[model samples]
Target: MKKTYDVIIIGSGGAGMIAAITARKQGKKVLLLEKLPTLGAKLKATGGGKCNLTNTLSSEDFMKSFGKNGRFMSTAINMLNKDDLREFFLSIGVQTDTKDGFRIFPVTHNSSTIIKALEAELNRLEVEILCDTKVERLLFDGESITGVQTQNEKFNSSNVIVATGGLGFPMLGANGDGYEFAKELGHKVTDLYPAMLPIYVKETWVANCTADTIAKAIIRVDLKKAKKLKAVGDLIFTSKGLRGPVILDFSREITPLLEQYEQVPLLINMVKGKNEDEVLQHIKKQTALNPDANVVEIVSTLLPTSVSKELCLIVGAILDKKFKDQSGQVRNDLVKIIVNTPFTVTESIGFKKAMITRGGVTLKEIDPNTMQSKLIKGLYFCGEVMDLDGPCGGYNLQWSFSSGNLAGHLL
Candidate 1:
């Protein structure tokens, strides 16, 4: 005889595990399926294994970070915000710390600690788990979920929650299975893009500045339509191009635009938001104090020695000449470059290098309140499978837990 579960949760990532736990707690028989031999493969690699679980942002501010589509998370976040997530972890015998007073992580500072706790909780609740099981397709009638078909066997359940996540980090078991399931069931899957990854730029000069980390750098898209798209954080120059916190966050916005344009032009404020006038004023002040300082020396006061030299070279400024000896046009151009350096983003590192994916199942097809499919009964979606994605810190993980919690209710 085939046994029937009250609910079947696909993929054992953070969302799937939390959904299984939540359903089992409701006294419903639950089944968690994972494609890999081990569960939480991607979760185990979050924050480079440090596991940023959640952040301290309030609900309103937190939602705003995700941009316009953020409102889709209202119900889920309300159900289990950062505070609730912390309490839930505490109850599960895992202590979390916000070392920076914002982003939360297990006190042990290991992603294994989080994965082990989640695994233990699922075990304690007696939720059936099946690793090395890849769901081939969802089994459903015309209007409702009947079960799921896996590679080796068929699972029986009226309710199914798809938490298969997005197609980022394929080596970590991300294969876009959830999007396929949603599409197979007549749901719309938006165009997908690789996000939160490093980018390659056209200018080879960035290679010369690889050794320096520019603090408080602001990167903005030079496109007229995307004039408001910008990010602020520490920036790093990679051998190929740009990376670090600023580029990672800004990549999400740029990836979509990349599909439309061959190369995206960028204006990088390397001097910590200093305008041309401000940079010129600083240079004039420095020149007044030391009348004999060369152009590189005067510019180095505002930026690293290497970056200053590069900017000076870009403007054709005589590196060994005093600031007053340089042509007025050369001086102005150097100041402009110092304030707003330009670069062209040629390409991204792609999904294999991306930390998360942009775009998933469109939000309108699923109800945020329950994470259940609006077009199909007994079907739910959670985690990166949905359209919502946020910047670094703890936004994405918290959304996974919250949406999973909402979907687990089986309401």
Candidate 2:
């Protein structure tokens, strides 16, 4: 059977929804296809359900968050800049607010609210959405994308937007199908691996002390070229090592080291921004002022009680056995431990457990301006489907919005 549409958008994610809405706004008949039973599966899971729709940082600061590919993302960011997003959300009735560090969330504080708002907007625009339907193949004419073949049937469209996300959580319906689709269309995909994942450490003490512990710490690492690097944020303990915003960010920087050294020794600073000499002097003075106090009690005042006790046992042996017994050297050593406790990042938690798939279809193969393919006309890529990945902020979601919006505008 023959099929027709002014625009066909694959992947009912944030990008897909935004693109569909944009295309519809352009007076184009639009349809969105999804393999999942519902739309916005990953969006529902983002920001722990609060859905950090987009960050509030300036375009310059926003561009810096992408790490290695910050400059390469200029096209998408320039197209759907932060102001565009704030306006879009307000238009869709999602009151947005920004917190510390420019992280933005809905005033309703619920991802469901964000999704519902988008769904309502899409509905109002009369965009057709198809869920639980998979696109079997892309029909291309070497010059442009003509249509797509789905499980139930075939369809034709003048414009096609491939906003399908990457392969992160299979349970959430991210099955690397987007990569397959891109490859099928003769796009070059980089080596796919999981990024923004938890770090696996070999330290038993970290595993035991950190288990179920809501740890807020900074990691200090000596980079190969960047010298000392530190990332500060809340960290979570896993059976193997650590996971959280800080750890995940730092882990990506040391992935190369992990691949080479099998384990990269990291310094976990439960207290960040404090220098070693300052910490030592503080500890020395505290110990001098309260020499008679029990060692655990004295140390507990300086650190988390449990962690302090464990550290006391590790460093206290150099001093006399008595609780309050400690020499200047030992006190200084204790401070050093606190200031720079080193741990190794062995390997990331692997792709299946990653928050978002790291690599995807190379951005060079796709036109940065319109998100259209350099090789395949009428085919556009957006969101995690491209090699573009960003830090833990709202940058990822913003990329989706911008890329989709770019495609929509181009359509």
Candidate 3:
């Protein structure tokens, strides 16, 4: 739309929108380019369309959850932190509330509300937005970014923010163009994986219990000897494999290991509160009280009937056998299976089902203080394009807004 602008941001996702708003707030001419006709397509689908805006964790705790690369986000996060994010939304006329004491969402409970609010803010700020505009390449002059080029023409700008997101949700227009741009510019892109997707297990029996959820299931992944990765929460059964808060959270760790092992082993603690011995004794006590009851019926009280039946099959226990008729070895085997149900993870459902991308442009190339490129001046990166992914809830959105604002502030 313009021959030159103060800031031209690629991709109209959360980071690009925030960057546009922040740059405009500084009285800079901003033009936002979107690949899709509609803006914020992925943002609209986040948190099942409610748009989890930010989390309620303390700043220190919040950064810790993101792992080592999170330290790079310290300055950006501190500059426009969670409180600032919530306040920004409130200032934009979107009142926010938190569910589960952490995940913050618009009180309206509709993601369109957020998109509307952002659009209104951009309109009020006079930031230009061009939809259905695909940026084919970056127009650079060796060390500094000059602008971006589409098929028909080149839009010139000294400052260009590449917020094209990651390889997650490709159908929503995230085609990894941002990573390609970074690679073309001599920046290193890390190995990418599905960050927050359900894992597919080799056991087909788990698929049959699609209606059942393993509440309070403790999921553990085998690491090197004498070490293991562990997470505790509910695991919801899916037609393909496993899904839920715990499985989604555990997926971050599970994906990297999946790369090396043919089958990543995951052990589930089906009965949460009891140890192997405690659960065995509990079963013995139950059998003593009702010796005539079927083993399936007794175990069903501990787990879902479908799951219990499957577990019995796995442990060589006959569901029709009375509890009193079951041998000690059968009892021990059943207890072991209940305490530690093993599943071999074949792979994740992949980017289509993944809520976020695990890796992107390496952290060292971008200055966290400003989100500007260390190698290429006037070029900035933010959001899922960076080598940063957080746990489920609202951390990723917060990172997007914070990093975008930081870049815009410094721009």
TM-score leader: 1
User: What lDDT tens digits, residue by residue, belong to model 2 across residues 1-411?
Assistant: 686998899998889999999889999999899888888988898877888878888888887877767776687788778888888889988888886758888887798998899999999999999999999888888788889899989899857888888877778888888788889989999877676778777666765566444356877765565456767788777667888887666665666566666767777777645778777666567778878666666656667666666676677633234343577666667777877776667677675666666678997898777788898888888888888788787878888898888888764
Q: Estimate each model's TM-score.
A: 0.98, 0.90, 0.95
- lDDT (10s digit) by residue, model 1, range 20-106: 999999999999999899999999989889999999999999999999999999999999999999999999999999989999999
* Order of quality (TM-score): 1, 3, 2
Residue 187 in model 1: lDDT? 98
Better of 1 and 2 by TM-score: 1
C-alpha-based local distance difference test score of model 1: 0.92
Which candidate has the top score in lDDT?
Answer: 1
- Model 1, which residues run further than 4 Å from truth? none
Residue 248, candidate 2: alpha-carbon lDDT: 64
